[model samples]
Target: MSRFLFVVLPVASHLNAPLAIGQALRAAGHEVAWCGPRTDLRPLIGPDATLYPTGKRYFRLDGETGMASVRTLWEGHVLPVNRFIRDAVDRAVADHRPDVVVVDQYALVGALAAHRHGVPWATFCVGALELTPPDLPGFGDHVRAQLGRVWAMTDLPVDDAIDLRFSPYLVLGLTSTALTGATPLPARCVLTGPALGHHPDAPAFDWAAWDPSRRHVLVTVGTMAEHLARDFYRRMMAATAALADRVQVVVTASPDVLPEPPAHVLAAPRVPVLELMPRLDAVVSHGGLGTITEALAHGVPVVVAPIRHDHPTVARQVTDAGAGTEVAFASATPADLTAALTAVLDDPGYREGARRVGESFAAAGGAAAAARHLAALAARPIEHCPSGTAALA
Candidate 1:
């Protein structure tokens, strides 16, 4: 059996995919351990899993948008987090002596640490931000420049040819071409769909309360953006009220955000989202990649209102794939939301498109496929690995 160490980002959306993949690896007889903040990892990973804590640090990107958001991500979050956890990751490498390290794309320090230790590593693409389109040459260059700056911090010699954000041996993209369209990816990149796994801490949902007579829709902006979704939730409540006879709405938010709801609507701070997806006819989302992919994986159409970060890109992909429609997050009116939701629900074409994407996702094999690739990489010698020279140098 091989040993695998996962260096993860503290964010929930980013953490979920790798968690699923790690579980898959462990089920296949491999040992798995995690490196990240203890406060966040403890509850999610539960008591049995081994964890190397890096303490806690907060990284907020509340009001930023567009290029400013990108700048904040690299300068505000990535660089600082790398500096904070660099020593801890290095110590984990030295102590654990893992055969392979699985690094979140955003956690560049993991890749550097693995390279320094001559351990093979795989890049886990948890979101669509790193999957650059051919037209966006400038954006790609900017990403390289940011990564270059991070590379310069070490005494190690610079190799401009290698993009540390992506592994030369393996890159597990948690998406399919059905959603990503025809965008070209790295030769080593594997599209492993969405890793839909069980959340042990998920709240118990009242399955008996669901009304099967009417069509159901789930309205959520995901975990991180709840503070920014109050207005959007209000608009959704108003819009869905008009279709009370034909549709039932489920909103995932606290009572403070949406205090009162109509008889046909269900409001809760947390819901069994994956368990509930199969029953949903349509989903109204903030265009988070995880939510969007999960919705499509279950053949549920989406109405995307992008907020920030890589949301706009994922929203555009949904629209381009003919599986959903998009609305402006800040400016969309009740009428606009109602119309978009109506279109996805009423049109059979949207459902067909969603099913097509769902089939492709099934073919991609999700976490099992990711585990297979990681195992294959582990079996190979370090001399044959792409980042092998970095250790020797």
Candidate 2:
């Protein structure tokens, strides 16, 4: 049995995908270990695998919830986080001495470690990755340029030979072929779609409890950026009140990490999206990829109000695909939102488009296909890698 190590981000969505893969590997009789911030190790350690938690402070923030806050931290932490992961992953690789390694898009250090050790490696990009092709090596320059607006630091001057120089095997973008009409990429840089784990078995809630007589808008900024949605969310509540007879509103507030909302909106705080998306007529969100995917997966039309980082990137994708409307933060006034959502919900085309994309997302074989690809790649012979001090690849 081959041995492997994984360096994954310690978030619910990000960690879930890689942890599932590691568990799958263990089920197939391979030995697997996880190395990272280690906030949640239980998910990575199935009956067969080992969990390694690198002791490091991931982020320091209190009661901050919103897309803006999440964006701020990610931007500021990239360099420092990369440095920390690099050191920790290097040490772990030396100790575990796994034959292969895997990481999330955000886990740069593990990728570097695999390269240094001459082991096969893959990066599972669970978000909207820069959509450049593998044949074009210099596309990193172009990617940084365009994505720079959303992730301002990415567009800044840096060593151009970063992404592909280290990882030539699999930059598995969370893209489904059915949606983009883009052909599958080479083995080294395939657009293997999202690998979400089976969602938690949430307590079943009554969807019929939400009345359909009035317009219903569910507001979610994202797990990290629930704070940024406060203004838009507040506006939505006011609009629902103004049109009380014409609409009903519901929101699952971000945990205590974010402040309580205005009483007009019922803060069903901690209601997981899996329980809520199926009941919503439409979603008002900061355009988190995961949220957008889930909403569409449930055939719910969306009005995207992007804040930072990949939010705008994902908004453009949905718009380009004719799946939703983009509502920039500057123009997200209550009246504007009411009008925009009214138009979108009234239009059958948006619903049809969302349904089509959701079908495409499903047809592309999300998690299972990713698992198959990963298993195949892991079984392949480890590639020869260059030697270095084992810095961030």
Q: Which candidate is the best by TM-score?
A: 1
**CA lDDT scores, all candidates in order:** 0.85, 0.63
1-393 per-residue lDDT for model 2 (tens digits): 777788876665566567656656666677778887654665346434466666665654333324443444444554456655566777888888876677776666676666566667777776653342223334345445433322222222333344532356666666665444553444366654555554443344445556666666677665665645566666776655665666566676754532554433545654556666766788877876777887787778888887765667677777877778988664567778777788667899888888888887677666666666667776676536343222223
Q: Where is model 2 poorest over a 10-residue stretch in terms of lDDT?
A: 147-156
* Model 1 CA deviation exceeding 4 Å by range: 133-138, 384-393
Candidate 1, residues 32-91: lDDT per residue as tens digits?
Answer: 999999988888888988899987678774767776667777888888888788889889
User: Which 10 successive residues of model 1 have the least lDDT summed?
Assistant: 384-393
